[model samples]
Target: MKYFYYLLFALLLCGCQETKKEKISRLVNEWENKEILFPKNSFFTIFAKDTIAFDTVDCDYKVFTYIDSTGCTSCKLQLLKWKGVIAKFDSLTHNNTAFLFYFHPKSAKEIAYILKRDNFNYPVCIDDADSINKLNQFSDEMMFQTFLLDKENKVLAIGNPVHNPKIEKLYLKLAMGESYTDKPILSQTKISVDKEMINLGTFDWQKKQQVAFTIRNEGDQLLVINGVTTSCGCVSTEYNHEPVQKGKNLKIQVSYKADHAEHFDKTITIYCNVPSSPVKLRIKGDARK
Candidate 1:
């Protein structure tokens, strides 16, 4: 009787272990098939490749060269080109290793300097003639895919126009000889705002005009406005000192001083954390003596 009880307990523990393993396997499969969307107006794609069964696709590539403030150059180029590349694809055909390159530059001038300093000697300008010919054998629209390739020119991953960070994590997991499962989809925050275009009409010297607008934060996240700037110095704006809470409205006050007699058209750009789009205010009027 004692032997039978021990055997029963062991069987139960093995059954529980098998159940956990099956759940993990299912999650991994789901992650492998997950689809990610690109950020607004961004062009990139992200995906994972098994590395053993994929091949490289033909595409025009551009290399981004980085030069430091001290004139030291860091050359890292994309293996795939961007020609005839669309933002969508079913899968990659190559089994190549992909690497993520990170760089930090203070300004756009540094980015430009690096490109010019190198005289474009990097491989970002190359295309595989054989791959190009084979890719061209397919329809033009079919040439839009970009794949991450291994050192041997095998496709390890594929993406469209947007890069997927989850896919990158998967690659990292594979490199570390670890397994990863799909993450649960998180709820997205929503943002909504009221936009208006104001016509200040005309103003005389020493006169001021008031333009009123409301800002509401409808997203789950807090909205932060870093600053407000005007195209011309004559215009000034003010917002409520308190942040507009979710489902609450805040007022924006813009005042324009007609210090000079001239025909003026100006714009106020509101720099905010709202991801839907940036808020733009238009102010137009003529100053009379």
Candidate 2:
């Protein structure tokens, strides 16, 4: 009887423990269609340069991103990359999308310098006390802190489009309306990589390691690579931007530099015109001192 009771307790514990996928599903259900509140009394600026007025146009959609005073500020902000994304979005949507950035800075001077250095002139809010995050109770993960909100400030989607190509596509589709299609019909190419995962084994932390992956075009259509993104600042990638002909292969060079001696697992995402628009590749290894 005692053994049966112990077994039942163990089974109950296993059932109570949620998997990563289940947790993500719960978070999505919680935030979906939820209205986001903005602090009306908060001040706005063009990156500390000048005071700016906040306006919500009736037909406009908003992309709100928040950065807390954790980790590398400049890396998390990526203001230069954001500048290009905003420019493209404005050009395509005819300035119908509003990008609202709220930062909880560890140092005001550092934030100011980053804005100036990146030449980011977009309007931003400095939530010194983290008022925005406090109200929203946003996810701790940086990737989930950004959201796409409709005219009514209700969340249409959650996730950073810049980091995830699928999220980017979803944002464009939601904002551009039903009839809008960005990719060409001939761009529906099929692609396959030589290896989806690579193990670098043990290496010195200070030493840089590089590896290449071969991507073959398996479809009749031309394979156009839109972009390649890395999960960490320490990891970088290089690849040809030109289209890949059918039955041809493109080499993607990935380099990793460890910030400290530790075990690391990082991902590289390839954004292309294939049915699976964003293909993910992972690299893992132990870094020794």
Candidate 3:
């Protein structure tokens, strides 16, 4: 009777497990039909032309770049190049493509100063809440982020066009009412970690400690981890979500605050495009106040 009960319990546990694909499917379906909100800006002015309203600007393509501080030299270059290339075509003249830049919410002061210093001749708007972030339907980490949207505000591609040929090609093709020739983007990841559990041993309750987990792209394709969720509020995380090429590694730093004197066990659930996503990481230690 004991043996039979054990077998039944094992079977029940196995049935409760979710496959890798099911998680990814769930993530995608959540935002598939969600409309991109072009939230109104706090202030907007054209560098050289008449001011325009957000809803009044009509175009088939909208390129959004988030800007704050001007520390990224490459970002400046990309912005310049984008302005030059986009200038050859104007939405006012029925070019069907519109490229606009925005301040990353509360960055208007810094961004405005930089634009003036650089003699930026492009349309820049102030969105104090980074409203454009909503367009990121499939990823997290919005720094240096850009999105290519269609007339109906559908996210067609998610990337920085600075010097990327693929993005430029995608833009030009779509502008001409054509489709891209490349394979569709997966927007998913196949990743594995070096360790599933981290043992912090013993620590003082008032002290804070951090442990690092090395995440690797073990598949033959790209690996993307968009978001991370913790089981407890006492734990926080920092990580890079850049596309992890095959064989490459990304590290996630988990910081735990020992506020209570007890044996602690915590889990960090990460969101990614993987076969077995929502990867759960474990951390444990004894804390003494």
Candidate 4:
């Protein structure tokens, strides 16, 4: 009917009106300074192999992360990445910050295997009953699930710094007792990419495929690329770390290695000193024999 179509149009328009910046602002406002509750009766383990007692240490800050069993366990946990982050923090703060990880897994065996495979030696709470998530009712978005907490477990910021460079800077600044600013102070510029979406068509699932994207600086100022982050471990990106001068082009090489035979859609985010700093590109296709 005409009325039904009009209703759908309004809904789509409203959805399009909400920008990523606005959404992040709203989420941060809702969670900032909120206290997080941790259930007492939870199982703890080290490297997912040895039984351990959960001990609370008095630290200046705590980075708490909760992973629920829904998607690929290895991908969601990203234990290897966590290992690096933990090392970095320890070097800087010297036990001033604690990393608390809780995972509610569908299969305890899979979780254990992933932990060991990644060689993650940190203590983790394997909540098979999902008690932590139930008690906290954490947000469904992955970005909002991780929290940078104060000594009392009050949220200082909500985001995974490992996945986002901007959030990492913010977390480090706040944790170190330094003044913080959410906005970047550098001059803003613009970028132009050859393509935002790359369709690989169909390829052998077991083999790796590579694609390159050309990004050119369209602004007068130098464009500094902070980092490039992927949605999954199966995908990786390579780019020059040096700043790209105006009117120059930079090549980004993205590689995808499928672990299973299925349709896949992965995201690659580029962080730069530009107005739209975090530009996202997609690679999607079917993997077959």
lDDT of 4 by residue, 219-279 (tens): 9988888878788777888888888999999999999987678788888888777756578
Model 3, global lDDT: 0.59
**Native-vs-model 2 lDDT?**
0.77
Clashes of 1: 27
The lowest-lDDT stretch of 10 consecutive residues in candidate 3 is 6-15
- The true-versus-predicted C-alpha distance at residue 63 of model 3, in Å, is 2.0
* Top TM-score hit: 4
lDDT agreement with native, every candidate: 0.40, 0.77, 0.59, 0.77
Model 4's alpha-carbon lDDT is 0.77
Better of 1 and 4 by lDDT: 4
Winner by TM-score between candidate 3 and candidate 2: 2
Q: How do the residues 174-287 of candidate 1 rate in per-residue lDDT, one tens digit apiece?
A: 333355554333333344546667777766756888887777777786666645645544566788665556777767788877645767666666655554333567777787
Clashes of 4: 0
RMSDs, each prediction? Answer: 19.5, 9.8, 14.6, 7.5
How much RMSD separates candidate 2 from the native structure? Answer: 9.8
Q: After superposing candidate 4, which stretches have Cα over 4 Å from the reference? A: 1-26
